[model samples]
Target: MPNTNGILGRKLGMTRVYNEFGQASPVTVIEAGPCVVLQKKTVGKEGYNAVQVGFREKKPSRLNKPEVGHFKKSGGTGYYHVREFKVEDPKIYELGQQVNVTEVIKIGDKVDVTGRAKGRGFQGVIKRHGFSGGRATHGSDFQRQPGSIGSSAYPSRVIKGKKMPGHMGTDKQTVKNLIVIDIRVEENILLVKGAVPGAKNGLVSIYIKKA
Candidate 1:
Protein backbone atom coordinates (compact mmCIF):
# COMPACT_ATOMS: atom_id res chain seq x y z
CA MET A 1 0.00 0.00 0.00
CA PRO A 2 1.09 3.56 -0.63
CA ASN A 3 1.64 6.03 2.16
CA THR A 4 -1.05 8.71 2.55
CA ASN A 5 1.03 11.75 3.56
CA GLY A 6 3.43 13.77 1.42
CA ILE A 7 5.73 16.79 1.44
CA LEU A 8 6.66 19.81 -0.67
CA GLY A 9 10.09 20.30 -2.24
CA ARG A 10 12.25 21.61 -5.04
CA LYS A 11 13.71 19.63 -7.94
CA LEU A 12 17.44 19.98 -7.54
CA GLY A 13 18.56 18.33 -10.78
CA MET A 14 19.43 15.00 -12.38
CA THR A 15 22.40 12.74 -11.85
CA ARG A 16 23.57 9.18 -12.28
CA VAL A 17 24.56 6.62 -9.69
CA TYR A 18 26.30 3.29 -10.22
CA ASN A 19 25.55 0.08 -8.37
CA GLU A 20 27.98 -2.52 -7.03
CA PHE A 21 28.16 -4.29 -10.39
CA GLY A 22 28.89 -1.02 -12.28
CA GLN A 23 25.36 -0.61 -13.61
CA ALA A 24 24.57 3.08 -13.81
CA SER A 25 21.07 4.28 -12.93
CA PRO A 26 19.75 7.73 -13.75
CA VAL A 27 17.88 9.54 -10.98
CA THR A 28 16.31 12.88 -10.40
CA VAL A 29 17.37 14.54 -7.19
CA ILE A 30 14.75 16.42 -5.21
CA GLU A 31 15.34 18.55 -2.16
CA ALA A 32 12.32 17.29 -0.29
CA GLY A 33 10.80 18.71 2.90
CA PRO A 34 11.21 19.96 6.06
CA CYS A 35 7.71 21.31 5.35
CA VAL A 36 5.59 22.79 8.10
CA VAL A 37 1.94 22.08 8.64
CA LEU A 38 0.33 25.48 8.42
CA GLN A 39 -3.31 24.50 8.86
CA LYS A 40 -5.70 21.59 9.09
CA LYS A 41 -9.24 21.22 7.81
CA THR A 42 -11.78 19.13 9.65
CA VAL A 43 -15.00 17.65 8.23
CA GLY A 44 -17.03 19.00 11.14
CA LYS A 45 -15.86 22.54 10.52
CA GLU A 46 -14.50 22.90 7.00
CA GLY A 47 -16.69 20.12 5.51
CA TYR A 48 -13.54 18.49 4.12
CA ASN A 49 -10.32 16.90 5.24
CA ALA A 50 -6.98 18.35 4.25
CA VAL A 51 -3.71 19.73 5.53
CA GLN A 52 -2.01 22.89 4.32
CA VAL A 53 1.77 22.65 4.34
CA GLY A 54 4.33 25.37 3.77
CA PHE A 55 7.91 25.15 2.50
CA ARG A 56 10.96 27.33 1.84
CA GLU A 57 11.66 30.21 4.15
CA LYS A 58 10.88 33.68 2.89
CA LYS A 59 11.91 37.08 4.12
CA PRO A 60 9.31 38.97 6.14
CA SER A 61 9.65 41.98 3.83
CA ARG A 62 8.78 39.79 0.87
CA LEU A 63 5.34 39.02 2.31
CA ASN A 64 2.56 41.44 3.20
CA LYS A 65 0.89 41.86 6.54
CA PRO A 66 -1.83 39.27 5.97
CA GLU A 67 0.62 36.60 4.86
CA VAL A 68 2.89 37.35 7.78
CA GLY A 69 -0.03 37.08 10.14
CA HIS A 70 -1.00 33.74 8.67
CA PHE A 71 2.48 32.32 9.22
CA LYS A 72 2.54 33.76 12.68
CA LYS A 73 -0.64 31.91 13.54
CA SER A 74 1.00 28.66 12.55
CA GLY A 75 4.19 29.46 14.51
CA GLY A 76 6.29 29.28 11.36
CA THR A 77 9.04 31.60 10.20
CA GLY A 78 7.54 32.17 6.72
CA TYR A 79 7.10 30.23 3.53
CA TYR A 80 7.20 31.02 -0.15
CA HIS A 81 5.24 27.89 -1.10
CA VAL A 82 2.01 26.73 0.47
CA ARG A 83 -0.05 23.79 -0.78
CA GLU A 84 -2.96 21.68 0.43
CA PHE A 85 -3.04 17.88 0.54
CA LYS A 86 -6.25 16.01 1.21
CA VAL A 87 -6.10 13.32 3.84
CA GLU A 88 -8.48 10.73 5.24
CA ASP A 89 -7.82 11.87 8.80
CA PRO A 90 -6.71 15.44 9.31
CA LYS A 91 -7.16 15.31 13.04
CA ILE A 92 -4.00 13.29 13.43
CA TYR A 93 -1.93 16.29 12.38
CA GLU A 94 -1.60 19.73 13.95
CA LEU A 95 -0.45 23.17 13.00
CA GLY A 96 3.22 24.23 13.28
CA GLN A 97 4.25 20.58 12.96
CA GLN A 98 7.16 19.70 10.72
CA VAL A 99 6.61 17.09 8.01
CA ASN A 100 9.71 15.33 6.79
CA VAL A 101 10.34 13.13 3.75
CA THR A 102 11.01 10.11 5.91
CA GLU A 103 7.57 10.22 7.47
CA VAL A 104 5.80 9.58 4.19
CA ILE A 105 8.53 7.78 2.23
CA LYS A 106 11.17 5.10 2.39
CA ILE A 107 13.41 3.22 0.03
CA GLY A 108 11.54 1.28 -2.70
CA ASP A 109 8.33 3.28 -2.25
CA LYS A 110 6.55 4.44 -5.39
CA VAL A 111 5.47 8.08 -5.52
CA ASP A 112 3.61 10.51 -7.72
CA VAL A 113 5.29 13.85 -8.38
CA THR A 114 3.43 16.96 -9.53
CA GLY A 115 5.05 20.09 -10.89
CA ARG A 116 5.02 22.62 -13.71
CA ALA A 117 6.84 21.59 -16.90
CA LYS A 118 9.50 23.74 -18.54
CA GLY A 119 8.11 26.24 -21.04
CA ARG A 120 9.04 25.93 -24.71
CA GLY A 121 7.68 29.33 -25.82
CA PHE A 122 5.97 29.85 -29.22
CA GLN A 123 6.54 27.00 -31.66
CA GLY A 124 5.42 25.48 -34.95
CA VAL A 125 3.48 22.28 -35.49
CA ILE A 126 6.70 20.47 -36.39
CA LYS A 127 8.31 21.13 -33.02
CA ARG A 128 5.12 21.31 -30.97
CA HIS A 129 3.14 18.32 -32.25
CA GLY A 130 5.68 16.39 -34.34
CA PHE A 131 4.04 17.17 -37.69
CA SER A 132 6.17 16.37 -40.74
CA GLY A 133 6.68 19.43 -42.89
CA GLY A 134 6.04 19.55 -46.66
CA ARG A 135 8.61 17.91 -48.99
CA ALA A 136 11.77 20.04 -49.04
CA THR A 137 12.78 19.40 -52.68
CA HIS A 138 9.29 20.15 -53.99
CA GLY A 139 8.44 23.53 -55.49
CA SER A 140 5.86 23.99 -52.71
CA ASP A 141 6.65 26.77 -50.23
CA PHE A 142 4.68 25.08 -47.44
CA GLN A 143 7.71 23.96 -45.40
CA ARG A 144 6.63 24.51 -41.78
CA GLN A 145 3.02 25.52 -42.37
CA PRO A 146 0.30 23.53 -40.66
CA GLY A 147 -1.34 22.94 -44.05
CA SER A 148 -5.14 22.66 -44.25
CA ILE A 149 -6.93 22.98 -40.95
CA GLY A 150 -10.60 22.92 -41.93
CA SER A 151 -12.94 21.68 -44.70
CA SER A 152 -14.30 23.89 -47.45
CA ALA A 153 -18.11 23.48 -47.43
CA TYR A 154 -18.81 21.46 -44.27
CA PRO A 155 -17.01 23.96 -41.99
CA SER A 156 -15.90 27.45 -43.04
CA ARG A 157 -13.45 28.21 -40.26
CA VAL A 158 -10.67 26.28 -38.63
CA ILE A 159 -12.04 23.55 -36.39
CA LYS A 160 -11.50 23.73 -32.66
CA GLY A 161 -8.78 21.54 -31.13
CA LYS A 162 -6.92 21.37 -34.42
CA LYS A 163 -3.22 20.46 -34.12
CA MET A 164 -2.01 23.96 -34.96
CA PRO A 165 1.02 25.26 -33.16
CA GLY A 166 1.12 28.01 -30.53
CA HIS A 167 2.60 28.11 -27.08
CA MET A 168 3.89 24.95 -25.44
CA GLY A 169 4.94 23.63 -22.04
CA THR A 170 4.76 25.33 -18.63
CA ASP A 171 1.77 23.17 -17.85
CA LYS A 172 1.12 21.27 -14.67
CA GLN A 173 2.03 17.58 -15.03
CA THR A 174 2.20 14.48 -12.89
CA VAL A 175 4.66 11.57 -13.04
CA LYS A 176 3.35 8.49 -11.38
CA ASN A 177 4.81 5.35 -9.82
CA LEU A 178 8.39 6.62 -9.68
CA ILE A 179 10.42 4.32 -7.50
CA VAL A 180 12.24 5.81 -4.53
CA ILE A 181 15.88 5.06 -5.23
CA ASP A 182 17.46 6.70 -2.23
CA ILE A 183 16.83 9.14 0.58
CA ARG A 184 19.06 11.49 2.53
CA VAL A 185 17.18 12.21 5.73
CA GLU A 186 19.60 14.78 7.08
CA GLU A 187 19.87 16.68 3.80
CA ASN A 188 16.20 16.20 2.98
CA ILE A 189 16.97 14.86 -0.47
CA LEU A 190 15.03 12.23 -2.42
CA LEU A 191 16.41 10.43 -5.44
CA VAL A 192 13.78 8.88 -7.66
CA LYS A 193 14.39 6.35 -10.43
CA GLY A 194 12.87 8.39 -13.26
CA ALA A 195 12.38 11.94 -14.40
CA VAL A 196 9.79 14.35 -12.95
CA PRO A 197 8.40 17.44 -14.63
CA GLY A 198 9.63 21.01 -14.11
CA ALA A 199 12.94 22.85 -14.41
CA LYS A 200 15.63 22.67 -11.80
CA ASN A 201 14.70 24.37 -8.54
CA GLY A 202 11.02 24.41 -9.49
CA LEU A 203 8.50 23.62 -6.76
CA VAL A 204 7.16 20.06 -6.68
CA SER A 205 4.85 18.03 -4.51
CA ILE A 206 5.54 14.36 -3.87
CA TYR A 207 2.71 12.06 -2.91
CA ILE A 208 2.49 8.36 -2.18
CA LYS A 209 -0.97 7.12 -3.03
CA LYS A 210 -2.31 3.62 -3.48
CA ALA A 211 -1.27 2.19 -6.84
Candidate 2:
Protein backbone atom coordinates (compact mmCIF):
# COMPACT_ATOMS: atom_id res chain seq x y z
CA MET A 1 0.00 0.00 0.00
CA PRO A 2 1.11 3.56 -0.66
CA ASN A 3 2.10 5.64 2.34
CA THR A 4 -0.25 8.54 2.97
CA ASN A 5 2.31 10.88 4.52
CA GLY A 6 4.62 13.05 2.40
CA ILE A 7 8.25 13.91 3.07
CA LEU A 8 10.16 17.18 2.81
CA GLY A 9 13.65 16.42 1.54
CA ARG A 10 16.70 18.31 0.27
CA LYS A 11 18.67 17.27 -2.80
CA LEU A 12 22.04 16.16 -1.45
CA GLY A 13 23.71 16.29 -4.88
CA MET A 14 23.60 13.49 -7.45
CA THR A 15 25.58 10.29 -7.86
CA ARG A 16 25.57 6.92 -9.59
CA VAL A 17 24.72 3.91 -7.50
CA TYR A 18 24.60 0.27 -8.56
CA ASN A 19 21.37 -1.69 -8.60
CA GLU A 20 20.73 -5.32 -7.75
CA PHE A 21 22.02 -6.55 -11.13
CA GLY A 22 25.14 -4.39 -10.58
CA GLN A 23 24.16 -1.83 -13.23
CA ALA A 24 24.85 1.83 -12.67
CA SER A 25 21.83 4.04 -11.89
CA PRO A 26 21.64 7.80 -11.70
CA VAL A 27 20.47 8.72 -8.22
CA THR A 28 19.74 12.02 -6.55
CA VAL A 29 20.71 11.84 -2.90
CA ILE A 30 18.01 13.53 -0.83
CA GLU A 31 18.11 14.44 2.83
CA ALA A 32 14.50 14.08 3.95
CA GLY A 33 13.85 15.73 7.21
CA PRO A 34 12.93 15.20 10.68
CA CYS A 35 10.38 17.95 10.18
CA VAL A 36 8.52 19.34 13.15
CA VAL A 37 4.80 19.86 13.31
CA LEU A 38 4.41 23.60 13.72
CA GLN A 39 0.61 23.81 13.74
CA LYS A 40 -2.32 21.50 13.34
CA LYS A 41 -5.12 22.88 11.22
CA THR A 42 -8.61 21.58 11.78
CA VAL A 43 -11.86 21.71 9.86
CA GLY A 44 -13.60 24.05 12.28
CA LYS A 45 -10.65 26.27 13.06
CA GLU A 46 -9.02 26.82 9.63
CA GLY A 47 -12.08 25.70 7.61
CA TYR A 48 -9.94 22.78 6.37
CA ASN A 49 -7.66 20.06 7.68
CA ALA A 50 -3.90 20.25 7.31
CA VAL A 51 -0.58 20.02 9.09
CA GLN A 52 2.04 22.72 9.10
CA VAL A 53 5.45 21.07 8.86
CA GLY A 54 8.70 22.89 9.48
CA PHE A 55 12.24 21.95 8.49
CA ARG A 56 15.79 23.36 8.67
CA GLU A 57 15.75 25.11 12.01
CA LYS A 58 17.25 28.58 12.12
CA LYS A 59 19.21 30.10 14.97
CA PRO A 60 17.34 32.13 17.59
CA SER A 61 19.31 35.28 16.72
CA ARG A 62 18.47 34.91 13.05
CA LEU A 63 14.71 35.00 13.73
CA ASN A 64 12.48 37.94 14.50
CA LYS A 65 10.29 38.33 17.59
CA PRO A 66 7.03 37.38 15.87
CA GLU A 67 8.57 34.22 14.46
CA VAL A 68 10.13 33.51 17.82
CA GLY A 69 6.69 33.61 19.43
CA HIS A 70 5.26 31.28 16.79
CA PHE A 71 7.93 28.62 17.27
CA LYS A 72 7.86 29.06 21.01
CA LYS A 73 4.14 28.26 21.11
CA SER A 74 4.95 24.98 19.46
CA GLY A 75 8.04 24.46 21.64
CA GLY A 76 10.54 24.50 18.76
CA THR A 77 13.55 26.50 17.70
CA GLY A 78 13.44 28.87 14.77
CA TYR A 79 12.33 26.86 11.73
CA TYR A 80 13.46 28.47 8.50
CA HIS A 81 11.14 26.56 6.19
CA VAL A 82 7.49 25.94 6.96
CA ARG A 83 4.75 24.52 4.71
CA GLU A 84 1.13 23.48 5.17
CA PHE A 85 0.10 20.09 3.78
CA LYS A 86 -3.47 18.90 3.51
CA VAL A 87 -4.26 15.71 5.36
CA GLU A 88 -7.60 14.02 5.70
CA ASP A 89 -6.85 12.60 9.12
CA PRO A 90 -5.79 14.84 11.96
CA LYS A 91 -5.85 11.94 14.44
CA ILE A 92 -2.40 10.76 13.34
CA TYR A 93 -0.91 14.23 13.78
CA GLU A 94 -0.23 16.44 16.78
CA LEU A 95 1.36 19.79 17.45
CA GLY A 96 5.16 19.67 17.93
CA GLN A 97 5.33 16.10 16.60
CA GLN A 98 8.44 15.31 14.59
CA VAL A 99 8.22 13.90 11.06
CA ASN A 100 10.96 12.05 9.21
CA VAL A 101 11.36 10.44 5.77
CA THR A 102 11.14 6.87 7.02
CA GLU A 103 7.69 7.17 8.62
CA VAL A 104 5.78 7.97 5.44
CA ILE A 105 7.77 6.29 2.63
CA LYS A 106 8.12 2.73 1.36
CA ILE A 107 10.25 1.11 -1.33
CA GLY A 108 7.84 1.71 -4.21
CA ASP A 109 5.18 4.38 -4.44
CA LYS A 110 4.01 7.18 -6.75
CA VAL A 111 4.59 10.77 -5.64
CA ASP A 112 4.33 14.29 -7.06
CA VAL A 113 6.92 16.97 -6.41
CA THR A 114 6.65 20.75 -6.56
CA GLY A 115 9.65 23.05 -6.93
CA ARG A 116 11.04 26.15 -8.55
CA ALA A 117 12.34 25.58 -12.08
CA LYS A 118 15.83 26.68 -13.08
CA GLY A 119 16.06 30.30 -14.17
CA ARG A 120 17.09 31.04 -17.77
CA GLY A 121 17.10 34.81 -17.75
CA PHE A 122 15.82 36.82 -20.73
CA GLN A 123 15.48 34.09 -23.36
CA GLY A 124 14.34 34.59 -26.96
CA VAL A 125 11.18 33.24 -28.58
CA ILE A 126 13.16 30.50 -30.29
CA LYS A 127 14.39 29.25 -26.95
CA ARG A 128 11.68 30.40 -24.55
CA HIS A 129 8.43 29.85 -26.50
CA GLY A 130 9.83 27.47 -29.14
CA PHE A 131 9.24 29.79 -32.11
CA SER A 132 11.15 28.99 -35.31
CA GLY A 133 13.75 31.60 -36.17
CA GLY A 134 14.70 33.06 -39.56
CA ARG A 135 16.77 31.18 -42.15
CA ALA A 136 20.46 30.84 -41.34
CA THR A 137 21.59 31.09 -45.00
CA HIS A 138 19.78 34.27 -46.11
CA GLY A 139 19.81 37.77 -44.51
CA SER A 140 17.99 36.59 -41.43
CA ASP A 141 17.37 39.95 -39.82
CA PHE A 142 14.43 38.55 -37.81
CA GLN A 143 16.63 35.66 -36.66
CA ARG A 144 15.87 35.77 -32.97
CA GLN A 145 13.22 38.47 -32.82
CA PRO A 146 9.67 37.80 -31.67
CA GLY A 147 8.58 39.12 -35.06
CA SER A 148 5.75 41.61 -35.68
CA ILE A 149 4.47 41.74 -32.08
CA GLY A 150 1.16 43.41 -32.90
CA SER A 151 -1.40 43.37 -35.70
CA SER A 152 -0.18 45.78 -38.38
CA ALA A 153 -2.28 49.00 -37.87
CA TYR A 154 -5.47 46.91 -37.54
CA PRO A 155 -4.95 46.33 -33.82
CA SER A 156 -2.10 48.88 -33.67
CA ARG A 157 -1.13 47.76 -30.24
CA VAL A 158 0.85 44.97 -28.55
CA ILE A 159 -1.58 42.28 -27.53
CA LYS A 160 -1.97 41.43 -23.89
CA GLY A 161 -0.13 38.27 -22.72
CA LYS A 162 2.04 37.99 -25.84
CA LYS A 163 4.55 35.16 -25.84
CA MET A 164 7.47 37.52 -26.47
CA PRO A 165 10.99 37.33 -25.15
CA GLY A 166 11.41 38.39 -21.55
CA HIS A 167 12.10 36.54 -18.31
CA MET A 168 12.18 32.73 -18.44
CA GLY A 169 11.97 30.11 -15.70
CA THR A 170 12.49 30.32 -11.93
CA ASP A 171 8.77 29.59 -11.94
CA LYS A 172 6.96 27.17 -9.67
CA GLN A 173 6.53 23.78 -11.37
CA THR A 174 5.01 20.46 -10.40
CA VAL A 175 6.35 17.09 -11.55
CA LYS A 176 3.74 14.39 -11.19
CA ASN A 177 3.64 10.66 -10.55
CA LEU A 178 7.33 9.91 -10.00
CA ILE A 179 7.99 6.39 -8.77
CA VAL A 180 9.97 5.95 -5.60
CA ILE A 181 12.47 3.20 -6.35
CA ASP A 182 14.23 2.98 -3.04
CA ILE A 183 14.36 4.39 0.45
CA ARG A 184 17.16 4.54 3.03
CA VAL A 185 15.67 4.82 6.48
CA GLU A 186 18.95 5.24 8.27
CA GLU A 187 20.12 8.09 6.08
CA ASN A 188 16.62 9.55 5.65
CA ILE A 189 16.97 9.35 1.87
CA LEU A 190 14.71 8.56 -1.09
CA LEU A 191 15.71 7.39 -4.58
CA VAL A 192 13.05 8.34 -7.07
CA LYS A 193 12.91 7.36 -10.72
CA GLY A 194 13.74 10.09 -13.28
CA ALA A 195 14.72 13.65 -12.38
CA VAL A 196 13.01 15.98 -9.93
CA PRO A 197 12.54 19.69 -10.66
CA GLY A 198 14.85 22.58 -9.70
CA ALA A 199 18.63 22.96 -9.23
CA LYS A 200 20.68 21.17 -6.59
CA ASN A 201 19.75 22.05 -3.01
CA GLY A 202 16.52 23.68 -4.17
CA LEU A 203 13.48 23.24 -1.91
CA VAL A 204 11.11 20.57 -3.24
CA SER A 205 7.77 19.43 -1.82
CA ILE A 206 6.77 15.78 -2.20
CA TYR A 207 3.14 14.71 -1.99
CA ILE A 208 1.13 11.55 -2.49
CA LYS A 209 -0.25 11.42 -6.02
CA LYS A 210 -3.91 10.82 -6.69
CA ALA A 211 -4.58 7.40 -8.10
Candidate 3:
Protein backbone atom coordinates (compact mmCIF):
# COMPACT_ATOMS: atom_id res chain seq x y z
CA MET A 1 0.00 0.00 0.00
CA PRO A 2 1.15 3.53 -0.80
CA ASN A 3 0.20 7.00 0.36
CA THR A 4 -1.98 8.05 -2.56
CA ASN A 5 -2.28 11.63 -3.77
CA GLY A 6 -5.43 13.49 -4.66
CA ILE A 7 -6.35 15.27 -7.88
CA LEU A 8 -9.29 17.39 -8.97
CA GLY A 9 -10.87 16.64 -12.31
CA ARG A 10 -14.00 16.70 -14.45
CA LYS A 11 -15.82 13.66 -15.79
CA LEU A 12 -15.13 13.86 -19.53
CA GLY A 13 -17.73 11.14 -20.09
CA MET A 14 -17.45 7.36 -20.56
CA THR A 15 -16.04 5.29 -23.36
CA ARG A 16 -15.01 1.72 -24.28
CA VAL A 17 -11.64 0.50 -25.43
CA TYR A 18 -9.72 -2.74 -26.06
CA ASN A 19 -6.73 -3.91 -24.05
CA GLU A 20 -3.55 -5.66 -25.16
CA PHE A 21 -5.26 -9.05 -24.84
CA GLY A 22 -8.05 -7.80 -27.11
CA GLN A 23 -10.45 -7.65 -24.20
CA ALA A 24 -12.77 -4.65 -23.96
CA SER A 25 -12.83 -2.60 -20.79
CA PRO A 26 -15.45 -0.03 -19.87
CA VAL A 27 -13.88 3.15 -18.61
CA THR A 28 -14.85 6.56 -17.40
CA VAL A 29 -12.82 9.30 -19.04
CA ILE A 30 -11.82 11.97 -16.56
CA GLU A 31 -9.88 15.12 -17.34
CA ALA A 32 -7.79 15.03 -14.20
CA GLY A 33 -4.96 16.99 -12.64
CA PRO A 34 -2.92 20.08 -13.31
CA CYS A 35 -4.56 21.33 -10.13
CA VAL A 36 -3.38 24.37 -8.18
CA VAL A 37 -2.52 24.25 -4.54
CA LEU A 38 -5.04 26.35 -2.65
CA GLN A 39 -3.96 25.73 0.92
CA LYS A 40 -2.00 23.37 3.15
CA LYS A 41 -2.52 22.14 6.69
CA THR A 42 0.13 21.34 9.30
CA VAL A 43 0.22 19.58 12.66
CA GLY A 44 1.44 22.56 14.65
CA LYS A 45 -1.35 24.87 13.50
CA GLU A 46 -4.36 22.91 12.25
CA GLY A 47 -3.68 19.90 14.53
CA TYR A 48 -3.84 17.54 11.53
CA ASN A 49 -1.96 17.66 8.22
CA ALA A 50 -3.52 17.89 4.80
CA VAL A 51 -3.21 19.63 1.44
CA GLN A 52 -5.99 21.59 -0.18
CA VAL A 53 -6.31 21.57 -3.96
CA GLY A 54 -8.25 23.66 -6.47
CA PHE A 55 -9.24 22.92 -10.04
CA ARG A 56 -11.00 24.21 -13.19
CA GLU A 57 -10.35 27.90 -13.55
CA LYS A 58 -13.20 30.31 -14.08
CA LYS A 59 -13.72 34.04 -14.55
CA PRO A 60 -13.57 36.30 -11.51
CA SER A 61 -16.98 37.71 -12.28
CA ARG A 62 -18.54 34.28 -11.87
CA LEU A 63 -17.33 33.96 -8.27
CA ASN A 64 -18.62 35.65 -5.12
CA LYS A 65 -16.64 38.16 -3.15
CA PRO A 66 -15.61 35.71 -0.43
CA GLU A 67 -14.36 33.23 -3.01
CA VAL A 68 -12.43 35.92 -4.84
CA GLY A 69 -10.76 37.03 -1.63
CA HIS A 70 -9.83 33.48 -0.67
CA PHE A 71 -8.26 32.86 -4.07
CA LYS A 72 -6.28 36.05 -3.82
CA LYS A 73 -4.97 35.22 -0.37
CA SER A 74 -4.15 31.66 -1.38
CA GLY A 75 -2.48 32.75 -4.64
CA GLY A 76 -4.90 30.75 -6.76
CA THR A 77 -6.98 31.61 -9.79
CA GLY A 78 -10.78 31.41 -9.67
CA TYR A 79 -11.51 27.70 -9.42
CA TYR A 80 -14.81 25.85 -9.27
CA HIS A 81 -14.03 23.24 -6.62
CA VAL A 82 -11.71 22.97 -3.63
CA ARG A 83 -10.97 19.74 -1.77
CA GLU A 84 -8.61 18.72 1.03
CA PHE A 85 -7.00 15.31 1.54
CA LYS A 86 -5.41 14.16 4.75
CA VAL A 87 -1.71 13.41 4.50
CA GLU A 88 -0.47 10.87 7.00
CA ASP A 89 3.31 11.35 7.06
CA PRO A 90 4.39 14.71 5.63
CA LYS A 91 3.49 16.79 2.60
CA ILE A 92 5.91 18.69 0.35
CA TYR A 93 3.44 20.63 -1.81
CA GLU A 94 3.35 24.39 -1.47
CA LEU A 95 0.66 26.97 -1.91
CA GLY A 96 0.47 28.60 -5.36
CA GLN A 97 2.22 25.60 -6.91
CA GLN A 98 0.95 23.11 -9.45
CA VAL A 99 0.50 19.35 -8.79
CA ASN A 100 0.07 17.49 -12.02
CA VAL A 101 -1.75 14.13 -12.05
CA THR A 102 1.28 12.30 -13.33
CA GLU A 103 3.37 13.16 -10.28
CA VAL A 104 0.98 11.35 -7.95
CA ILE A 105 -0.79 8.44 -9.62
CA LYS A 106 0.79 5.79 -11.86
CA ILE A 107 -0.82 3.35 -14.24
CA GLY A 108 -2.69 0.44 -12.54
CA ASP A 109 -3.02 2.07 -9.13
CA LYS A 110 -6.26 2.15 -7.15
CA VAL A 111 -8.17 5.18 -5.99
CA ASP A 112 -11.45 6.28 -4.49
CA VAL A 113 -13.76 8.75 -6.20
CA THR A 114 -16.24 10.99 -4.47
CA GLY A 115 -18.85 13.05 -6.25
CA ARG A 116 -22.43 14.25 -6.22
CA ALA A 117 -24.72 11.96 -8.12
CA LYS A 118 -27.20 13.26 -10.70
CA GLY A 119 -30.55 14.42 -9.44
CA ARG A 120 -33.50 12.20 -10.16
CA GLY A 121 -36.64 13.95 -9.10
CA PHE A 122 -39.45 12.59 -6.85
CA GLN A 123 -39.79 8.88 -7.50
CA GLY A 124 -41.69 5.83 -6.25
CA VAL A 125 -40.62 2.81 -4.29
CA ILE A 126 -39.90 0.73 -7.38
CA LYS A 127 -37.44 3.15 -8.88
CA ARG A 128 -36.23 4.78 -5.72
CA HIS A 129 -35.82 1.81 -3.39
CA GLY A 130 -35.88 -1.21 -5.65
CA PHE A 131 -39.37 -2.59 -5.07
CA SER A 132 -40.32 -5.43 -7.34
CA GLY A 133 -41.60 -4.38 -10.77
CA GLY A 134 -45.37 -4.05 -10.91
CA ARG A 135 -47.65 -6.54 -12.55
CA ALA A 136 -49.01 -5.49 -15.94
CA THR A 137 -52.32 -7.38 -16.19
CA HIS A 138 -55.84 -7.25 -14.72
CA GLY A 139 -56.86 -5.79 -11.32
CA SER A 140 -53.68 -6.35 -9.34
CA ASP A 141 -53.24 -2.72 -8.35
CA PHE A 142 -50.79 -3.23 -5.49
CA GLN A 143 -48.15 -1.92 -7.95
CA ARG A 144 -45.41 0.35 -6.60
CA GLN A 145 -46.86 1.62 -3.33
CA PRO A 146 -44.67 1.57 -0.24
CA GLY A 147 -47.22 -0.97 1.09
CA SER A 148 -48.23 -1.17 4.76
CA ILE A 149 -46.03 1.46 6.30
CA GLY A 150 -47.40 0.57 9.72
CA SER A 151 -49.45 -2.14 11.32
CA SER A 152 -52.77 -1.69 13.18
CA ALA A 153 -51.74 -2.72 16.74
CA TYR A 154 -48.63 -4.07 18.45
CA PRO A 155 -45.83 -1.61 17.78
CA SER A 156 -48.36 0.66 15.99
CA ARG A 157 -45.54 2.86 14.79
CA VAL A 158 -43.63 2.84 11.54
CA ILE A 159 -40.10 1.76 12.23
CA LYS A 160 -37.33 4.15 11.40
CA GLY A 161 -35.09 3.55 8.38
CA LYS A 162 -37.83 1.75 6.56
CA LYS A 163 -37.50 2.03 2.79
CA MET A 164 -39.98 4.42 1.22
CA PRO A 165 -40.51 6.60 -1.80
CA GLY A 166 -38.63 9.89 -1.77
CA HIS A 167 -36.08 11.91 -3.65
CA MET A 168 -33.43 9.95 -5.52
CA GLY A 169 -29.93 10.71 -6.70
CA THR A 170 -28.48 14.19 -6.06
CA ASP A 171 -26.67 12.73 -3.08
CA LYS A 172 -22.97 12.48 -2.35
CA GLN A 173 -21.48 9.05 -2.95
CA THR A 174 -18.09 7.31 -2.96
CA VAL A 175 -16.84 4.42 -5.08
CA LYS A 176 -13.72 2.77 -3.78
CA ASN A 177 -10.78 0.93 -5.27
CA LEU A 178 -11.46 1.69 -8.89
CA ILE A 179 -8.55 0.44 -10.99
CA VAL A 180 -6.64 3.07 -12.94
CA ILE A 181 -6.60 1.84 -16.50
CA ASP A 182 -4.77 4.50 -18.44
CA ILE A 183 -3.16 7.91 -18.06
CA ARG A 184 -2.30 10.62 -20.55
CA VAL A 185 0.18 13.15 -19.21
CA GLU A 186 -0.24 15.66 -22.01
CA GLU A 187 -4.04 15.84 -21.70
CA ASN A 188 -4.10 15.16 -17.97
CA ILE A 189 -6.74 12.51 -18.43
CA LEU A 190 -7.42 9.33 -16.41
CA LEU A 191 -9.18 6.26 -17.68
CA VAL A 192 -10.40 4.25 -14.75
CA LYS A 193 -12.02 0.84 -15.24
CA GLY A 194 -15.64 0.39 -14.13
CA ALA A 195 -18.15 3.12 -13.37
CA VAL A 196 -17.23 6.19 -11.33
CA PRO A 197 -20.47 7.08 -9.58
CA GLY A 198 -22.01 10.40 -10.70
CA ALA A 199 -23.35 12.13 -13.78
CA LYS A 200 -21.25 13.33 -16.66
CA ASN A 201 -19.21 16.48 -16.01
CA GLY A 202 -19.72 16.35 -12.27
CA LEU A 203 -16.89 17.47 -9.99
CA VAL A 204 -15.27 14.44 -8.36
CA SER A 205 -12.68 14.07 -5.60
CA ILE A 206 -10.05 11.46 -6.35
CA TYR A 207 -7.78 10.24 -3.58
CA ILE A 208 -5.22 7.55 -3.00
CA LYS A 209 -6.29 4.51 -1.02
CA LYS A 210 -5.91 5.11 2.69
CA ALA A 211 -4.71 2.44 5.07
Q: Largest TM-score belongs to which candidate?
A: 1
Q: List the residue pairs that clash in candidate 2.
A: none
**Candidate 3 local lDDT, 8-104, one digit each (tens):** 8888789988978999999999988788878778899899888777888888889898888889966737888788877764466667778888887
Relative to the true structure, how large is the alpha-carbon lDDT of every model?
0.89, 0.79, 0.82
lDDT of 2 by residue, 1-211 (tens): 2223576778766777777899977766677787888888789888988888898889999999889888986785878788888888765776778887777766677888887889999888999999987767666676666777888767789989999888999999988887777888877788877677788988888887664
Model 2: runs farther than 4 Å from truth? 1-4, 22-24
Count of clashing pairs, candidate 2: 0
Clashing pairs in 1: none
The clash number for model 3 is 0
Worst 10 residues of 2 by lDDT: 1-10
The better candidate by lDDT, 2 or 3, is 3
- Least well predicted 10-residue stretch by lDDT in candidate 3: 1-10
Candidate 1 lDDT (Cα, 0 to 1)? 0.89
